[model samples]
Target: MLRVAIQVKELISSNVTSALDSMSSSAKMLHQLQREIEEAIIALEGERTKTERNLKRLKATLTQNEMREADWGDKAKAAMDHDREDLARQALMAREDCREAIASGKDDIAKAKADLKEIDEAVKELEAKREETREQAKAQSAADADKSGCSDAGASTAEKRLNRVSQMEKRTEFATEDTASARTNASVDREIDEMRRASTVDAELAALKGGAKKAPAKRARKKA
Candidate 1:
């Protein structure tokens, strides 16, 4: 049972660490973690039920032993009253055996109680961690939503800027001959600036994608 508890603890720890590290898949990971914890709890409850039944049996046995010991004592007294030394000696020996059995039963009951306590503690810890994981998953989902909203807002702003630049270029193309050369040069400069901005954005996006890919690969290696 102790070994089983330790294994559950290790599994919980690993799941939590992996979920935290893999933000993109945190929801799935946390869901899996919750299932594992529930399974562990079920297993512990089963063990607890068995231990409780055994404890009850042990107490019943102890009670019967005590009653038998009392019966032997009564027989021993009756034998003495009748002046039967051999019968009295046998009764006394039977009482001693009952006493030994009572002692062993009490010890067994005590150990069963200890085992139940340990199982209860493990169940409690798993429940608490399960709740904590749920909260973390909620927080991660909110963070992802915020990130997506920010990205959409940025793309919208970039689209509006590009539209304005396109309008300016159209106006320049329709300019009179007197200012046509100057407008053309200005349009070329604007185009160059736009290309530079687009290139920079693409490079940054590619780098972000590379980092995202590396994170999972690194996690896979660690898991292996």
Candidate 2:
């Protein structure tokens, strides 16, 4: 009976370890996915900028072509007034070419605008999905931590103790980082003091070299 109990305990420990590992992998994957989504949104914004510039250029060209078509019609009318059929015919034909260019430019602009709209919608959807994923990952982590209960086939006492220790270690590591940050701030103040001394020394030397009046000496505090 003792041997059978030991075997069952070992099996439960193995299963618990496996489940914890799977949960860890899921958490890591979710974190990586969140980062990738942020990068994709940045890239989408860059593409949007390029597309906007292209749209602006297309619209500018379309405007120029439209003006040219109007000028061609006036030229054709003037030629006919001077009884020059050949010139009038050429002007009318050139106007058709301008019309074609304007049509093509408008079409390109329309497609680019549509692409921008679609990209905007995609960004919004992705941001929403990323937020949802963040919430889900948080809930899953909490649930995994909460699901520790009395099951005869569940994790053994040793396994639960190890998990608790692991969590405590993580919290302790965060505390260590806070201590390190405090040390960094103290060092920064020392560095600032050194900078002030160095600057005063440099200013004194510069004054002597330039034949300027010497700065007043700072009086040391007397012990009262």
| Best-fitting candidate, scored by TM-score | 1
For model 2, the superposed segments whose C-alpha errors exceed 4 Å read 1-25, 141-224
Writing each residue's lDDT as its tens digit, candidate 1 over 1-224 gives 55456546555555445544554543445565666677778888888998999999999999999999999878866665555556766776677678778988999999999999888888888888778777876886676666644455644644553343223122222224558678769978878866765564455444444555576678899999
State which candidate has the highest lDDT: 1
Backbone clash total for model 2 is 0
Per-residue lDDT of 1-224 in model 2, one digit per residue for the tens? Answer: 12222322332334223433453324434454455456556767777898899999999999999999999878866665555656766776677678778888989999899978876876776677568556666766666677654454333543553443233112223224577678869988878856764564355334333432222222223322
TM-score of every model versus the real structure: 0.54, 0.51
Q: For model 1, what is the C-alpha lDDT against the true structure?
A: 0.67
- Stretches of candidate 1 exceeding 4 Å from the true structure: 12-26, 141-224
TM-score of candidate 2 against the unseen true structure = 0.51
